[model samples]
Target: MTPRSVPHPRGVRLVEGGADVAVYTESAEAVEFCRFDSDGNEHRTRLDQRTGHTFHGFVPDVEVGTRYGLRVHGPWDPANGLRFNPNKLLLDPYATAVEGGYDWGQPVFGHDMNNPDQLDESDSAGSVPRCVVTDRHSFDWGDDRPPRTPLAETIVYETHVKGFTQRFPGIDESLRGTYAGLAQPAAIEYLTDLGVTAVELLPVHQFVQDSHLGEKGLRNYWGYNSIGFLAPHNEYAAGGDGGQQVDEFKALVKALHAAGLEVILDVVYNHTAEGNHMGPTLALKGIDNASYYRLVPDDRAHYFDTTGTGNSLNVGHPAALTLIMDSLRYWVTEMHVDGFRFDLATTLTRQGGDADVHSAFLDLVAQDPTLAPIKMIAEPWDTAGYQVGGFPAEWSEWNGKFRDDVRDFWRSADSVLGTVSQRILGSPDVYEPTRRSPLCSVNFITAHDGFTLADLTSYDQKHNEANGEDNNDGESDNRSSNNGAEGPTDDPEINDRRNRQRRNFLATLLLSAGVPMILGGDEMGRTQGGNNNAYCQDDEISWFDWDAADQGLQEFTRMLIRLRRREPALRPEWYRRGPRDRSTPDRVQILRSDAKGFDPPDWNNPTARTITFVFHHDDADSFALLLNAAENGVEFTVPKAPGQEWRLELSSDDAQRVEGKVTTLILEGRSFTLLRSVTRKDVRGWARAHGYEVSSKGKVPRQVQQAFDDAHR
Candidate 1:
């Protein structure tokens, strides 16, 4: 007999005269609700467990400031990812605010791991932080229009949340390093002043610390690990009064939008911070691990280990996909976020059937009219599956080739000029015919994973000692070259060269034919103390130093961004294919410093040091850029054309080295030149810098002088 009725516990689904907010619990052998009061007073409510539980009745009069938590019960299985102990007290996965910090006690880790399932029966009672209830709603957001900045026009600044403002003097002490800090007039002004069109935040979702990092007295600095999809990291929001993180974050977004900037989140849907099969049994694992994660292909005993953190999310499952899609929609529709940069996106497209490039996950996102209109970016690669330009249309991917080629040209380009040409034109060979637009490629030199522009010119190899991994971590071959020294010095010659190289790289980025992304602090010269993977340090080493600037760098950065916004050609869309479309050549023209016009460059050309490329925009518009990366100057000549005079607007050889904005005469030598257009008998500045040389019949000399005169225009 079913024992007439097993004494059912008392419960409440709708708090008497309360609001619509409700919480649910999956298992309920033991569950209860506790409300905290300001005067240290507390209220208790019993929830029925015998009948099982999924939701807690909504309580009223509970506005913005509400604190509550749950008590649960279950076996504390460790190896199996099941850590349910009612005594320890757990935070709600949907929690917006949390009380207390990681106590670092044994309770923090689900299982003793060492104790083994054969040993400890300890409940780890009285430990673990509790979740706080948050009553979030709409904001006034007047005229809070998203920048709606075109992907092609965006220059992203990837940065850590806390590190960005904690030391910023302009932000209030309490607000510094908080979502509120990012919204302060000062923070908003800094972004606009610096000219970054979008701020690609690392991650905002609540996440767990890497067990290794936790034991080592460190924490995950980069927020790549995620726990709850809808919940924001409480640590990232300031003035944590009654779980106000949601409001604070929304406020920050509104402020950024008001400043004419967009917010692009670096989202990690690839995996959860919950590690692999041997990891802790958090919400998902506790609910249904087999369903939420891709169990190692055909091996049911293991999880797909593509995320490096140990497990890959199974987007193939509807519930899992719902979680991700819901989170994305909430951020876009509810929070009004501008876009997302999917980390290790290739992993998301892998299907058990075919792993089609046009997978279901992508198909859904692309078809969603509302979501499709937003800026969609993809990291596009990962360790398990690296797909460079393989993502479908309606998305822009980080062009690793752009990073590599640009790095080579300036660092090792002296020896590999051919590779440089392929990159400057948007890596069309790799991304074209996919029918993807040119803007689909996000070109960058230094990102958060590699050395900053400053370090690229300062350190030839990664100095990852600060990462506590002894120099074994990070990329071994960065294709980087320090003009002379290793890190820093007072050697004026080397420093000058390094600074010039930085200028060259930045200029090239703005001039390229793809969406450009500028790593944060690359402008003010931020360093990770040579720690390329400083994802564990939350100190000054990762922060953008507010004091390091010499005026020259700042002006140069600002002017470049403004000019980038000026030219339509620089921000060209995908090359639409048609009869009118320019049939791109396999290898086009590369004008040598001494050459007159376009011709194929010889890799065996032992004497060649500088090569200027003239990108022909299908008989419509063409701009020629000269790069004399050699230590000394090269006497470049303007090739014979319609004698069109090439007017030089920007040059690195300017006496002031003023960048960003300029209106000056054409300069020469030891300089990189950007010329607009030219006319008949108009030479693109050739001989004057090297001084005049004797010519045959005096025509050649005069011709060179004519080039110089054109250059001076």
Candidate 2:
């Protein structure tokens, strides 16, 4: 009987009585399909089927649990970027699920370390992980649908799947640090109650732990070093026995969707785990090194590294481009993901060794039907270059400018008020020309890479001594203030100031115009002991400290998110400027401390520290935000509303609500105030309910007002 074959869908697809496997390799002289038995016995079978640059074969009685790998026999010349060694078993680039762990002790490199000119003769089959054939249709995804939360309404919570739940007391011990743990009822409830529409999970792809980090007894806690693009990390699956990782991941997605929360994956398409020329022979490097990686024109042996990862993926090549798109589509269609956040996304847009706005990769992604609609976010810059505010209109960018300016403003850096104002208004200075909405800026104060929110307030210097690089591995210039004391302090005043600063950061992020992304564990005041870069610390250093969480801060963060959701003036869909319309009070006006009007001198004043953001909404109710960044308390005259009176809604200083017309309000230095304006009827009712003698038009008697003010003070 003739062997059946297909070339369109490239992975190992299970059929009625057999499996159809297809792989692409442009430079392979011969491609051999290898199978592993229960006892790890190798069975070699030559692929007789062939299409243009793709090898397809149909094997009979290929069971679902079959473990397999591919061997590409090609040139051994590394100088010309043709590194193909059949001795080292290569993982299937399109493997949906991978089995076993890679051992770094074994010779996994194509070229011998002792002799770089000679090929490595050692067989790496035992050390290398094999791809497991899985039944894609096995998981019963009953009524699982992406939340499809509007971008304008999205509140992203960036978290690591393992680090998020590794020490979670609410989850079962057996399921901790796994996908199941993240989908636990307790976890879902926490996220849902926090009012975040989506959870942007750190990479869950099957990645290779760095050999050097392993030697140092530290692992890659952050899953950025990926080897298998299409496979879920089996180590993250609670039920690891048999090929249940795929299903476990699917179930996690299903559970998140069921709870009305979207899952956005932080995908690393910029580079692979395979390091430079001396790197191990994994999947892409071993199969087709030159085609998959961006090689140096002068020296093909070396790679053009843009991600600070040894080798960058050549998105300029069609094969590599298709693989990225295929993997993304697989996650969306098969695994049921809502969106993606591209790591080192600027590297993917490089064409001719320069980042381009209209690069081939971006154009392809914009044109692709499967990917255009989903939420796409870009880290927007690579290690080589900074491309903030440089992404296209279709995508949202992680606003590095917003992060820096917010940190600087809170740290009392001079000349930052203007920049912070621009950032809070969704960075119209950056995205206005593109005609993108405020959602184009993904505003975040702290992210996974830098210091956690708690640490940002506690440490001014990075203490990465445990990472074994003499405190040189992480970033310097942390843009943080220790508030008169380094690390934890016993002084009550210092601690209070630190806590207030943290609240200020959270309020600023959540109350900003663009989409807000809270770093996981920040709400609970999780700290990394000043280790800003804890990428290699897989132990307690990186895990979420559930035992020592600040419950007050958590509740405060929840309240902030709730307020952001409740107030439309906080999360405006469009960029707020002069006014939307005169008929309805749809205007965003910036006023001086006197609340008169915007003056050039007042805005240009270098010593100025207070401004009022009056958000005149279409509804009768409006919001007046007063931000005071001075060291001394400032008196801000409330901006006159057309027909409504200002009522104290919320204050970062923990001030009590004092309703009625707020002619002049006192805002503490380095504090924020949120006031809501109410109508005549509501003000009168509030005044009456508070035991104040109110006139017919809601104006309280002079003595009654004085009593209320004294009581609040």
lDDT of 1 by residue, 1-713 (tens): 11122221112112335322333333334444555566644455544323333443434444445565555555554344344554444454455556554444565445556643432334332344445655545566677888888777788887778888878889888888889988889888878887889998888877766767877667787888887677778888786734677778888898889888899998988898667655654456544455577775545556777768788888887657766776788788768899999988888887563346778799889878779778888888876666778888778899888888777766544555666655676777777767666688888988888787888888877888867778888887558767889998899978777778788888888877778888877877776656777788777778777777446877887877876776554555554232245676422345666555434646555444577766443333345677866666556665433223455556666552323223332223334776654332223223423665543332445567555654554
Error of 1 at 453 (Å): 1.0
lDDT of 2 by residue, 473-497 (tens): 7788559877778798899978877
RMSD of each: 7.9, 3.6
Candidate 1 yields a Cα-based lDDT of: 0.67
Which 10-residue span in candidate 2 carries the lowest summed lDDT?
577-586
Worst 10 residues of 1 by lDDT: 1-10
Model 2, position 391, has a per-residue lDDT of 84
Question: For each candidate, what TM-score against the reference?
Answer: 0.82, 0.94
CA error at residue 678 for candidate 2, angstroms: 2.7
